[model samples]
Target: MSHSSTIARRTTPGRLRHCRTRSERGAATAEYAVTIVAACGLGGILVTLLKSDVMLNALKHLINYALKLAGVEGLEL
Candidate 1:
């Protein structure tokens, strides 16, 4: 038998390769759901950190320094 005949026989109908195609449906949707869940978890963590007192104080300090550089008086730092 030639190489082409062997290749064609392996890919014929009712083969294992054909069987796998049916089970591959909805695979993309499962992957999308996993990515969305991970993104939501990370966003929640970042929001909690940004809302903490230490982060807020650092932001306030940065704003005060910027205003002072621009020579605006009475920022109440």
Candidate 2:
């Protein structure tokens, strides 16, 4: 075939695919970082909520209910 067609066949599609893959790979790193940050923020909020007196009481009640269902004595907490 022609010289230009030979060059296009060898280089163009491969280079385009490589460039797109590199850009998408960089975006994946940013996506992971944002996901980790959001997860950490959510975990912090959950920890704070669970430590509150209302949530503590609710958890204690739930535990006591489970114990009662299992025919065991409930905890005093």
Highest lDDT model number: 1
Q: Return the lDDT, model 2, position 62.
A: 91
State the TM-score for model 2.
0.69
lDDT of candidate 1 over 1-77, digit per residue (tens): 99999999887876865465667898989999999999999999999999999999998999999999999989756
Inter-residue clash pairs, candidate 2: none
Question: Residues 1-77, candidate 2, lDDT per residue (tens digit)?
Answer: 99999888878766766665544767977999999999999999999999999999999989888888888873555
Residue 24 error for model 1, in Å?
A: 1.5
Total clashing pairs for each candidate? 0, 0
Report model 1's TM-score to 2 decimal places.
Answer: 0.58
Q: What is the lDDT of candidate 1?
A: 0.89
